[model samples]
Target: MALRVDGDSPQNFSALFDLRGTADTGELRLTSPIGSTLGLARWSPAEAVLDNGSRTYRFDTAGELIRAATGADIPLDALFSWLAGQDKSVPGWRADLSQVDAGRINAWRDSPLPRAELRVIFDTP
Candidate 1:
């Protein structure tokens, strides 16, 4: 994913991920190029935590956990929708699911200042 937040330089990242469970309580695992685990984020209503092999970090909510890692406020609810092929709209983000079947998804945000963009590539079972 490549993200451009209005005032800051773009942030780019690529990984193999597995997101399981519901938005309220789930696990998001990030893997490296050679298929090694990089980080694992797990969240519930009361708390969110990330175990990165070496250490662990904690946050108050899933949103905070995401922001801390990606520097964006990614609504988990909307994310789940897109993953399921729903073109659901959010206040500041627009998603292009046209190529989802081809293993790609693109989304961008342009509201509340510090505009941002997100691109994802995945494999479907």
Candidate 2:
């Protein structure tokens, strides 16, 4: 996932995430841009774990772990649906799906502070 958050501190974070499981049980592995293993995040209804290289970080929720790692307030679950071309509405954000057929997605946040935009382009596999 290549995420660029432009607001107070402009952050360009790109990671490879393998997401597996349902709402009750799920695991997500995040890798560096060069494909080196960065961390493995596993979560169930009652537990969440983030194993980074030599250290392990635990959080109350997957969202918290993700936020701590990425420093961006992104809606992970909704993002999966969005990438699938679903029109999921995240509060304070709006997406443009008109060009999704062209392998592109553009979204922006207008409320709760500095305005930011997110653009995603899927590479042909």
Candidate 3:
């Protein structure tokens, strides 16, 4: 999957996802050259889950998670930032993150470091 954010808006972002692989135990194990084996993502028609062992993230099909494991509401920017920081090999889209609501920003501030598992959502072209 490829994600592109245009302008300073998270809503302006575009995601392209290409899924391949078999489903096992309600999980879709995809192998993409852009991702790592440690990255395990599971998705169903209603929800998406990403588990990296220490942290588990659950998001709606719309790519919005009600709350992170830290009990914090991760803003769109911080979420992308945290994800970008994980694998440096990912493209340079990190520079596009924009300011979000203060309430959302505070959720991730001073929070415990996230586990290696990073869950992302993309629109299938």
Candidate 4:
């Protein structure tokens, strides 16, 4: 994943991730390029938790956990919808699905200040 925020330096991340279950209840594991575990996150309606080897972080809602990691409040439901080939509008973000057929997606946010961009590429149909 790559993020370019207006004032902050661009942030680039390369990881193998596994996301499963629904938007409200799921597990997200981020692994480094060399196959080492970076962090593991699990969430349910009741709670959200992130284990990063050295420490654990907990929050009341999954959104909080996500925001803490991404520095943006991305809607989980919208993300899932996009992965399924639908364009779900997000308040401050725009998504380019033109290349989705080729396993590429581009999204950007310009509202609420600190414009940012996110890109995702996958190797699957």
Per-prediction RMSD in angstroms? Answer: 1.7, 2.9, 14.1, 1.8
Against the correct fold, how does model 2 do in TM-score? Answer: 0.74
Q: Residue by residue across 1-125, what tens digits does model 3's lDDT show?
A: 22222223322111233334322223434344555444456655677687755687778641343233223233433444433332222222222222232111111122232212223543312
lDDT of 3: 0.36
Q: What is the lDDT of residue 95 in candidate 1?
A: 91
Q: Per-candidate TM vs. native? A: 0.88, 0.74, 0.28, 0.88
For the record, the alpha-carbon RMSD of candidate 4 to the native fold, in angstroms, is: 1.8
The pairs that clash in candidate 2 are none
For 1-125, candidate 4 gives per-residue lDDT tens digits of 45555656555555677778889999989888888999999999999999999999999999999878777776788777777779999899899888877877788888876677777776655
Q: How close is candidate 4 to the true structure, as a TM-score?
A: 0.88
Higher-scoring candidate on lDDT, 2 or 3: 2
| Cα shift from native, residue 80, model 3 (Å) | 24
C-alpha lDDT of all candidate models, in order: 0.83, 0.73, 0.36, 0.80
Q: Kindly report which residue stretches of model 3 are placed more than 4 angstroms away from their true locations once superposed.
A: 9-35, 52-54, 62-125
Clashes of each: 0, 0, 0, 0
lDDT tens string, model 1, 16-120? 788899889999899987999989999999899999999999999999998888777877888877887888889988899998888788888887656777777
Comparing candidate 1 with candidate 2, which one achieves the higher TM-score? Answer: 1
What is candidate 4's local distance difference test score?
0.80
**Evaluated with lDDT, which candidate comes out highest?**
1
